[model samples]
Target: MKLLVVGATGTLGRQIVRRALDEGHEVQCLVRSFQRGAFLREWGAQLLRGNLCAPQTLPPALEGVEAVIDAATARPTDAIDQVDWDGKVNLIKAAKAAGVNRYVFISILGAEKYPDVPLMNIKHCTEKFLAESGLDYTILKPCGFLQGLIGQYAIPILEKQGIWVMNGAAPIAYMNTQDIARFAIAALDNPDTVKRSFPLAGSRAWDSNEIIRLCERLTGQDARVSRMPLGLLRTVKKILTYFQWGWNVADRLAFTEVVVGSEAIIAPMDEVYETFHIDSGEITTVEEYLGEYFSRIMKKLRELDYDREKASKKKLPF
Candidate 1:
């Protein structure tokens, strides 16, 4: 099938494009510029110049597109209403008019529950729009991304920076981006996935302190930890909201509310695995994922040290 992928340059979007192409499907990406998408073109996926903010740019891109995989999102710096919500609304309309067969959407876990969080609210609203758009759609709500956690916690720990662990941060089942892509592409074919939504998560849910301890053990170093009270976070978020330009910052701060809730952000995936015909054992765990990352980073650091030692020795008299 000829497929159209929105947000093709994103972490999860690129994976979907790569996997979709490997599966022998014709892939097209909707990007704002061809230059930013040069690598995507090199990957053999056709690039269509378009932006979700511009509704006029969408219909043309959806032409002859059999399936549409929308992994696009607004950044913290971007307005969620314009990009995430309105942009997706336009894309949904365009896909409907283009007579697209199937649509796959990526959403966060419990999007509707976190109405105060700007990003999550927009995502939930988009999901509702997509569901009611009279199109065949599959929504995949992911708990969290392991790749994000690495940057948020692991790298900071290595640099001896303050690890921001909240008073009562929730445990999250963080899955690898590659695995989510697998589920998204798999949904493109399975009839069972149509008009259905599934939660994609890792084998286990891990909290902040647990992850911090894991990183310390892996790198053999103590983390510079910053434990913020949940009350302080709320106060900061409230203060930021008072300013016109600080709304975006405040919105992001509200995201912590989702994690600090009564229960962890997780779901039962036994049925999901069976429906998608995926083996539970194949899922990547935090230990394996983090272990590989630390190993690679440690090797690079060791190589850098060796080069420095070699240069220093050359300057010595002996």
Candidate 2:
């Protein structure tokens, strides 16, 4: 069966495309740009160019597609009205119009339960719609992405301040992007996964302090992570991002709950991981994950430094 992957160029989407290809499924990748789709094309995916806002643009993209995987995202405000709510709405409508079945949607854990979080709330609304859409659908609500932590904040913090920073020592379940991709591929291949929503995470939870300690041990640097006060952290984030984004807002609230309010009992990491098969007593440990993650980050940093050196040399007025 042919599968269509939206947002094929994104961090998690790329992994999903790779896993689907490895499983011998024919893949059609929908990307916003042709250039960005080259990698997917290289991996034997039929790359289609289209924007998510227009339903007509997607039908042709979904032509001859049996299943559609929506791995796309946008800003919360934009996503709630567009991707999560309306984009999914359009995808279902288009999938039906194009006669496609088995729609696999990637979401986040705590969506239904954490409706106070704007993005999760949008996803909750979208999930409600998806359940009512009358389509063979599988919704994957993965826990916090491990890759995002490493790339979005850790490496930069390590390089600049030689540490990872956070508001409080709260243990949260996290999952590798690769594992999430593998699970999605399995769900897509197995008919049993249809009409189900699975929450995924690592086998264990690690707090910010523990994670930084692991990184310190791996990198051979006694990098120390200084805890930022919740109020101060929020102020810094607001200033740095110019109040445009708030992925950190949830963390602040969680920290406040633990500090000023009740000690929130986060679900057992094993339970969440079990749903994704990572907690079934077979998965990488935190040490192993951190080792691999740090090695990759170091390699990327080296490459970036080398590229900068070469660029600087070329620009020299000799």
Clashes of each: 0, 1
Question: Candidate 1's C-alpha lDDT?
Answer: 0.90
Regions more than 4 Å wrong, model 1:
315-318
Task: Please report the candidate that would top TM-score against the real structure.
Answer: 1
- Computed on alpha carbons, the lDDT of every model, listed in order, comes to 0.90, 0.71
lDDT of 2 by residue, 209-284 (tens): 6776676677766654555566664465456444435444443443333322222223454543444444455555
- If scored against the real structure, what TM-score would every candidate get? 0.95, 0.78
Clashing pairs in 2: 82-87
Q: With candidate 2 superimposed using the best TM-score fit, by how many Å does residue 167's alpha carbon deviate from the native?
A: 2.4
Residues 1-318, model 1: lDDT tens digits:
899999999889999999999999999999988999899899899999999999999988988999999999886678878998889999999999999999999998899987768888999999999999999999999998888888788999889888777887889999999899999999988999999999998888998889988999999999998888888988998999999898888877787677676588889999999999999899889999999999999999999999999998786566
Query: Which segments of model 2 are wrong by more than 4 Å?
Result: 75-80, 152-154, 157-164, 224-226, 232-282, 295-318
- Screening candidate 1 with a backbone cut-off below 3 angstroms (N, C-alpha, C), the clashing residue pairs are none
Q: How far off is residue 290 in model 1, in Å?
A: 0.4
**Model 1 collision count:** 0
In model 1, how large is the Cα lDDT of residue 28? Answer: 96
